[model samples]
Target chain A: MPRRSFELMETHIPSLRRYALVLLRHDEPLADDLVQDCLERAMSRWHLWRRPGNLRGWLFTILHNIYVNDVARAVARPDVVEIQDYFPAMAVPPNQADRIRLREVTAAIQELPDTQRQTLLLVTMEGFSYDETADITGVPIGTVMSRLSRAREKVRAASWGETRENGRRIT
Target chain B: MSDLPEIPTEDEIQALVDGRLDPARRAEVEAWLSENPDEAARVAELRDISGAVEQVYGHLLERPIPARFQNAAAPSMARSPVWRVAAMIVLVAMGAAGGWFANDAVGPGGDPNVNLARGAVKAHQMYAREVRHAVEVPASEEAHLVAWLSKRLDAPLRAPNLDVQGYRLVGGRLLPASDSGPAAQFMYEAESGERLTLYVEQNLTGGETAFRFTEYDDVSAFWWKDGPLAYVLIGRGGRDSLLTLARATYQELNP
Candidate 1:
């Protein structure tokens, strides 16, 4: 329990919060709660963390597990909030048109399947390597790449006014 | 060179957009893109998607981490509800001792300056003892350090010159304030190896307070609110000497 370890872990909290917010589709309170849970779990299991291991990836693995568990629990309940209801409060950006585009992009990301969305965010937004993303998501490297590709394609299509419905791509 | 394909695979194209390709492969992809305008446009679209994703979510990194999450690593306080309640009672008692009359003074989401000071002290204790990695950005890059921290905290910040007091700038790191914002911690060290840290955060309550002192174990902190920000100077020195440093820091920052 050296102080250095705590300090190092603290450095990663902002990134953790960022990942959590995206994973939970910008539900700030729920995201913070998940991060708190992840950190507490990490602290209790600090001994399992090898000294030279990638701590960021380790924390993400823990967070992804907790999120999956929470999703499972929520699916059992009847009053689950619709994922569409959690769009971020639009912070005022300098440009009006850019804000609209940004909102569309965010919505498109939200429309992705859970696995695809997780892979896309971890690689594109959080800047994790493909190997690290696969490790964190517990998928093979090829699966990670395919998920990311599909996610990006869907987002691109959404922006261009194309949508996929009932196994058919439509414009 | 022989391994280079005539047309990049989808993964390789995605990697090209992500800037993950090695130089030789990247050059090969760019050469192909130059010949294939349609494929190049698709690559551009992929790049735009990533950029938009970052644009949509990047500000979360700047937001202050909540108070509860800040202590997630503390062993005694991690999961126990009883300890959390006890911790709240202790905070309220400390607020009363400090003569703050408002019920929320130092309570959860109450007076943020008190929480700021506590955060400052915690950061000092955690980082000041380090021989290396003491600060995220070192004093040699003082301009970049100031600009980066100021941007994160959303306030213009000045690292006070403590040269006259024999402590030089050791650099600074951005910390999560107990409230919903970022705090900046600038570390300084004397020739004798004694270290001090100056913590700054955006003032939530605009009401300015005169300098107040607090001690936690061996470390002492002098904190106050000035114009747009709150300040805390933490050190292990005696009161008068640390006060001298605090006053010097205050003047440097305000002026």
Candidate 2:
């Protein structure tokens, strides 16, 4: 590992954590564990990690992969999360209604199909662009957009306490 | 005559949000958003969702690096593959510990400390390249500088003299090194505008303690361990000059 590579990893650590936290859901220990694992992979692979003009995106790809890899996820979940709680945005004005709505979003994410969940988290949760989403999830670009669209529709419908019929959400 | 307005389909709205739409479709979505305030509001809501997710989970990204990762996987320093392709993954420069020379990617020998020196040398090279603020303590204050560094490393030493080789101390600094402890760097410059740096850290505990060299592009690095400290000299100077500097460093520090 070149000296700069570790620097790169350090700079990217926070962004990696943001993505992990969403998946791990304020589960500090597990989220931290996952981020650490991702960094180790990132430092080792930093050479092949052509900036591709997006180091942040590349890191999210590593993190998301680790999250979904069955063995690793199994290892990550058991000791880290305690029922996956809410992080209710600090500035949310502390309204019961707002908290309820936030629950809808997280719950919808949890209910999303794996493809939709990962894609939504990568795009919406991790701030990766659609193109980078494909790179991270190893899915087609169309798939990333479609999954995001489906995920959003599900969240909105779920938010309204409604149902989604195929792609259409009944409000 | 016309009571209905053209609305970009939901797909087009998604394409717009995804930034995947062509300029023509994008213009159409803008026109739609302008006409339908309600839909535009929803789009803003969704973007907020994206931002919120980043907010909630992004904290992990911002938190202190966990300690467990510092002591994570310890692969063998030697890679003699059960699979042949694992060779490509070894770092391009392994320093004295199978660095750039060994292409073994997947095995049980990837040492974190090996990555440590690589991290320091790379930091030295970068900060040294900056002319305006090359070092926190310019070599002009060798005494106070030595006192400061000695306190950090918990050791007694001055900037080892390199004037014998036409290189004078540019300055020194104490930096948070790899996953290990702190590191001390003594940078030098020759009259001809060439620069070299000796990055040193002591008592490397569980890392590979060997003498190795790696060349990345025009830069050459010579790394070795002497007694209780590890040193790497980074420079673009020829092998002979760089090696002489490394030896001078060893003699000055050890003798």
Interface root-mean-square deviation (Å) of every model: 6.9, 7.5
Report chain A TM-scores, every model: 0.80, 0.78
lDDT (Cα, tens digit) per residue for candidate 1, span B166-243: 789999999988687798999999999999999998888887666777766787788877777888899986554675
Candidate achieving the largest DockQ: 1
Worst 10 residues of 2 chain B by lDDT: B80-89
**Candidate 2 lDDT tens digits, B68-184:** 444223221111111111111122345443344344462234564556546656776688788887888988898898898878877675588877567899898887765557788
Off by over 4 Å in 1: A2-4, A72-94, A162-171, B1-5, B76-255
Sorted into a CAPRI-style docking class, model 2 comes out as incorrect
- Fnat values, one per model, are 0.46, 0.22
Error of 2 at A54 (Å): 2.8
TM-score of chain B of 2: 0.55
